[model samples]
Target: FMNYVPDMQKNHFAKEPIMTPPSEVFVTQTIYADANGTFHFSLLKAGQWGFAALGIGEQKTYKGKALSQDAVIWVQATKLP
Candidate 1:
């Protein structure tokens, strides 16, 4: 995660970016980059998924037929071992 500065030497915010780990450590780690508005997981389940993110004042969910659909947040569950 990075910040955009109008006339600064580097692209770093005054405050460091906030990083939130997943609730359960055994499963996987969920990192959220607020500055970059992105997220990633340590592990991904290979199958169709229904995602929903709820925050203080935000709530969003998606139910796609397949994980490869053209959507904001869709995961293409590729066969893996």
Candidate 2:
């Protein structure tokens, strides 16, 4: 998990433009998936969370070039009433 930043710098990767701020990350925890390629997180704090699964896709190549597809998601959790 990481904190959200309002301002960010410009950076590019794989023909894609990215903007990320330089700030201290709150947490960097690694979780592994089971044989079915499924994972879960529990007891999470109420806030914004970011999840990324890098290069975990089945397709290893595309158009004769090595390709690694990544997945990312962002979620906002609120406290229970």
Candidate 3:
């Protein structure tokens, strides 16, 4: 299970479709806010299903750094046949 916390203050866009099947499982990316209020994008899922959450404000930290300081976002996915 993957716990993905996002920043709500910042807009988030999924590269792939939200609802998908197990075989059609695809990877998606979530962009974070940049220094100028912009967002830096990235890829996720890779090819799987689980759950996630999204909100405003910086919640968790990663690699000795804060995930976000404006908002937070969460996402959840499931693999079906």
The candidate scoring highest on TM-score is: 2
Which candidate model has the greater lDDT, 1 or 3?
A: 3
Candidate models: Cα lDDT each: 0.40, 0.67, 0.45
Off by over 4 Å in 2: 8-26
Residues 16-56, candidate 1: write the lDDT tens digits. Answer: 32343344563333445565456655334344333333352
The 10-residue segment with the lowest total lDDT in model 2: 12-21
Give the higher-lDDT candidate: 2 or 3.
2
Superposition error at 51 for model 3 (Å)? 12
Comparing 2 and 3 on TM-score, the stronger one: 2
Q: What is the TM-score of each candidate against the true structure?
A: 0.30, 0.56, 0.21
Candidate order by TM-score, decreasing, is 2, 1, 3
Off by over 4 Å in 1: 1-31, 56-72
Q: How close is candidate 2 to the true structure, as a TM-score?
A: 0.56
Q: Please report, as a residue range, the 10-residue window in candidate 1 with the lowest summed lDDT.
A: 64-73
